[model samples]
Target: MVQTTFKNNAVTLIGNEVKVGDVAPDFTVLANDLSPVSLKDSEGKIRLFSVVPSLDTGVCDAQTRKFNEVAAELGDNVIIYTVSMDLPFAQKRWCGAAGIDAVQTVSDHRDASFGEAYGVHIQHLRLLTRAIFVVDTEGKVAYVEYVPEATDHPNYEAAIEAVKALTK
Candidate 1:
């Protein structure tokens, strides 16, 4: 379990927490098309997992768009995926409305197994904490960033740099 305290308030996360150098655990998530998409599907490609609480928030929306823009520049060697708790239908609508076509958006609504396994599930808030993970071709995590504050943005530049390094 992952424990985080903010301004004297404490929250605990239940389930496995991903860390740098750890082999990313494979999980199935619903894609925008409502089809099952697994982490193994992106094997042999640099994977960028952008985990957000919801697409409805400003920070989450900004993060997704930022990754979408970066993914376009990162080329085909990297596969960028955004994971959220929103429904597949909602994700599809949000992506189309936000003009987010560069990165794939996935939903974890049916079960939070993906979120729980990744240790992004917030027990108290019942939402995921903003986090980012980069997995190499072998499924080993190369980078990880868990935003300390739930309301803040992630380190976008650092994540992009990490992805670039994986390509070279």
Candidate 2:
């Protein structure tokens, strides 16, 4: 169980963080293209899941671009998506300005249903804490990392290793 503190108060996540071998919860998010995309849509492919609070921040922006660059090297077999509470327009603009073309940017502004389902929602902040989950082709989680602090970056090296393991 991971505990997160916001505004000096700590809150516990209701469920265990999604872990290796656990089936990822299916989600419907608005893509940068403004199309509804679900976990089912990316089934049968290696997924690099990057979940962040918002795209308007420096860390979130860096995280998305870094993943986009890494995704290119991983090729078409691996699909990467960065999720946040930003609107689709903002996400699209950020990606464009950053020249991030390899990774898809998705939004959870509608209800944050995806964040709640993944147990990454920051109750008090109304934002998502940085987290990552790598779901294998069979839909089982291969790796999961919920950054201890909302202001920190996720473990990118470990996430990349997880994706590499999936390709083996």
Candidate 3:
């Protein structure tokens, strides 16, 4: 149970906490078109999972945009995903409005599978806490960062460097 805060108030997160060396857990999220997407879908590629509460928020928007900008430089070997509890339709709309082409926005609104499997699920709110997970080409978790505060940004530089390290 990883403890996190939303607006400085402690919140309970219910799930099996994933660590740096664990095998990246398999979970299903819905793509913009309601297609089921699993971790195995991007097998043999470096995956950066940007977990956010909701894309409608300011911090989530910035986080997704930042990764979208970096995705171009990350090369085809890397696949960046923005996971949120927002509905698939809303995610599609937000991406289009934001011009976010590089990062694929997936919705966990259906069953919160990604949230529970990744240990970022906010039990009370039914939303995921802000976090970043970098999965290597072989499906091993290389980096895990559960942002302490839901509203604050994760260590972007560190997460980017982690992916860069695996790319090399």
The numbered model that scores best in TM-score is: 3
What TM-score would each prediction reach against the true structure?
0.93, 0.92, 0.99
Q: 98-156, model 1: which lDDT tens digit per residue?
A: 99988999987777767888988777766777789999988999999887776788899
Per-residue CA lDDT of model 3 for 38-157, tens digit only, reads 999999999999999999999999999999989988889999999999999999999999999999999999999999999999989999999999999999999999999999999999
Model 3 alpha-carbon miss at residue 127, Å: 0.6
lDDT of 2 by residue, 1-168 (tens): 777654345765533468778998897889877889899998899998898888888789889888987887786789998988899999899888888889988898877767877888776566777899999999998898888777777888999988998898
Winner on TM-score between 1 and 2 is 1
Clashes of 1: 0
Extract clashing residue pairs from model 1.
Answer: none
lDDT of 1 at 168: 86
Where model 1 places Cα greater than 4 Å from the true spot, the runs are: 5-9
